[model samples]
Target: MTVNARSGLPKDRPAAPAPPPPPGWRRWLVPVGVLITLVLLFLPGMGRGPAQVDYGDLAQQVAAKQVDTLRLTADGTITGTYASSFDGGEDFVSHYPTGLQGVDDTFLSQVRDPSVVPHFQATGATGSWLGTLLALLPFLLFLGFFLYIGRAARKGMAGGLGGIPGVGRSKAKVIDAVRPDTTFADVAGYEGVKRDVTEVVDFLRHAEKYAAAGAVAPRGVLMAGPPGTGKTLLARAVAGEAEVPFFSMTGSGFVEMFVGVGAARVRDLFAEARKRAPAIIFIDEIDAIGQRRGSGMASNDEREQTLNQLLAEMDGFDPATGIVVMAATNRPETLDAALLRPGRFDRQVTVPLPTQPERRAILAVHAAGKHLAADVDLDTAARATPGFSGADLANLMNEAAIVAVRDDRTQLTAADLSQARDRIILGQRQGANFLLESEKRNVAVHESGHALVAALSPAADPVDRVTILPSGMALGVTEQMPEEERHLYSEEQMLASLAVRLGGRGAELVVFGEGSTGASNDLASATGLATRMVREFGLSPALGPVGYSSDSPQYLGGEQVTSRAYSEETQRVIDTEVARLVREAETTAVELLRSHRPALEALTRQLLEHETVTGAVVHAIAAGSTADGATRAPVSA
Candidate 1:
């Protein structure tokens, strides 16, 4: 279906009008003159013949009165139309050496009588440097023409003077000399993704069996996931397993400033791929060119033209041709519908964040060259990194190695891995031990608030670790680790989470008599979750089963132009509900902190002394265990 670039709507095809012919005689004038000049420059001796006649012989001929017509030129060359044929033509000329005393006009006039042909007659100018240059002009023009064509063909021009024939040809890199050294084995985890791509490789390897079974091969495969999830690596693994040609290009590489250039590149790419059957063409970051047509305000004719060409090529290719198109995009939702159709990118292999086991495998793969101490456990590291992608895991291993090097140790220890995880998650510790005593006390109370609330709330995730030590953008952190990844959240759990987020502010207000900016991050998080609960999750009674919030792409972030989707009155109600949810959660946190002031003070003292505390210690303290665990502590407000 052809889409209108402006409206993005499909319509009936209209025949294109013929282009008007160029106007005026001037259009053909330069070419005609050039042709004539070329012919004249190389024309066989118009009125002259080549002959090495001696000057004395010419003078004898003139004295014998054999020369009828004599012509003298400005350069002192003399030509005469012979009375009878001399060489092959009627005319011949010889240099009248100017070395002698100035030419004798009377003697020259005597060469021919005035009655026959005028003596000392004027002739065309003799050959000089100017004439030599004119003679080479045609060859020079031809050389320049070829050179321009070569340049244009080699590096596609952007149009205008740079316009060269075949400028639309694709700049796609052809990898024929070197095959992908990476196989599926080299890639860690993503067993499902590997299985998906492996089928394509299998089809390429044994096409005859599938053909006999009456199965048509998938034309294209799309790997969609977050960035650095091993999409490109998986495509390379497919290429390696198949062991065929791989044509690699990015979506941006197709388009040029000139119109139709992108379309030409798409054509050229497929043509090249078709020539090498059983080949894989991988396009990285395909969202750049594959976005829904006519969706944006600006009309991009070049990009649309390229997309049309790509669609045509994908539809035109035979599955049996052994050409598979593979593409990777972090934003698959943005791609055009035509591109994701069954005949195009029929297979979509989603590469999600690695699971705990997968992360362990990924760590092991990246840890191959590194020396790990006996205490360093991949399982423990994997458990610490839940939402980490494959790339993140690889980076973790690299950072751990760096940490080991910084400590001047040859082997990576558990501490190194833990520090690396902290760096990756919370960022590097800032200000180190530079906090003032009062600031340290404040930070301790702030984090203690969060840890205490999480421990007291039955539905909240357990605090993994808490510290008053400043890191990155935060003055302190309260890290929570879920025992198992939870896909669904209960209302009570969400409420508890919101309360925990507000715990720090509630704690500060209770002990210090006022809240501080240190709880700014916690407030923001709690507010957002409360708003989501009311507006999106339909958890608010006032906003009852209605979603007023914008529907944003889950992974890509940001709303997709969705508005409030409700009346002003309903919006007010939503705002009221959101505020109420946050208030209720904050009130619960305040009440909980007020009831456990003794525990808060004890935890704050521990934080100020240790600067960091584990969730186990917080749990024990919250359970009424003494600081030394020998005596029970009474909880008092």
Candidate 2:
């Protein structure tokens, strides 16, 4: 078995056979035929015929006694050989008036001399037929060219630029019933998602078994998740494992500028799938056409028609036919109810972000052939990257390799991975040499405050690294990596998180007696966290145990404007509680900074000198030990 160099998956399918070569004579047939046709079309005009002159020029030449012999036809064509002392002898052809008695008599009188008279011949039917055929040659060629194009378009060739004839054909990429390039092994994790889809594979492989037990397979499976969570990959893996024909198309592929085009495409897609009975149809990003239908100006008639067609096709197909439809979408909430209803999409699978173990596996899959140093720990990397999807993990591994290459190294080290993580999360590091001395000192102090608070607070996550170097939009950064993933947050943890977020502003207030614009991000984060704690988490004493926040989708990362369910008076109280929580957290941060002034100063000095300090050093300093292992008096609040 051969392995894919990039993905590290074994090639499962046999190599396709090369097409047999055509016969040698057949290869030259087209060019020879084209040559023969061209010769036939222009052969009569190719020989040394008379140089055709205008009627007036011929009249002038004949009037000057330049003609040796002339032949005139009843159709008005004239041909002759002329001799001139200045130029030499030449044969020429011209035309004169014919079937007009007065014009012919006048021309004949002008060109006729005492010694010479033009010979006239009657035109034959053969000449007339040849002239008509030559006149219609260009139109015939044009018609033939269009006919060739129409034939190719009907056969769905020329990259599917099928023109009018293929407008209603499905644009799906059809993979045949041979094993595909990807399988379950290619996908790193999400075992539950794999299992859920594997059942579909089994049903396709053994349809008779399911029928014998009177078990009906699901008509459709809907994979809904945040973007880049491997929903589409899962569908492909299902097709690969089952060794069935796979028809894949995106939701936007069905939509077109013309009305009813989308509906026509839907019909074509289902009909094609039916032709290959045991096949799978996978549509990605189905929400584009499957959006909730609305009546009014807001409704899109074309999109609604497409959705209606899709609904009918899904309900029209039988599961026992061994055909299954799979779809993926990031915005499941936007999908129409008819698309997700019982008999349509019977199973809705949620593919969420990878957990820590899953992330480690994903990293390993991406790290297949990459060189890593001994200290490059994947577990540590996975632990640090919480809420990362499989795509993110893959990107992280690639970024780490890039960092290694940037440093002129072949193997990725721990520092390379760290830098890669920082680059992804906090943006690239900016040159600190351009910073003013006062600004540098202020940034060091701000980050030191955050580090000290996080190290001292038991509920807060451990401070991973603190830096005064500017990165992205921040003047300083203090990163805290959680030891493990936590699905639920206690009230204490929430309050400690708020304090850690406010620590920078608290330090600025304590040291300079005022807060700078550097604390803008911290202030915003603290305010939001405190509000969530009070309103959503119901951690506020004044608000009691009732959750007051609106029901917005959590996975969707945007601020949604929702109508408040409570009255104006309750809103006022909620606002007061939110402010109180933020104030309490800030006060706690200020008191902690005031008490551990020595540790804060020590940490800030280390940051200013080295530009970065680790969590261990901060913890040591907070515990009354210098960074270089020197003992110091412990500071307490």
Clashing pairs in 1: none
> In candidate 2, which residue ranges exceed 4 Å CA deviation?
1-163, 317-320, 551-562, 626-637
- Model 1 per-residue lDDT tens digits across residues 215-306: 88898999999988899888777767765678999999988777778887887788788667667889999987899997866778988988
Q: Each model's TM-score? A: 0.72, 0.74
Q: Model 1 scores what on Cα lDDT?
A: 0.80
TM-score of 2: 0.74
**Candidate 1 wrong stretches, greater than 4 Å:** 1-167, 317-320, 548-562, 626-637
> Model 2 over residues 512-566: C-alpha lDDT tens digits?
8899998888888887887777777878889788886664543323554456668
Model 2: colliding residue pairs: none
What local lDDT score does residue 606 receive in model 2, on the 0 to 100 scale? 93
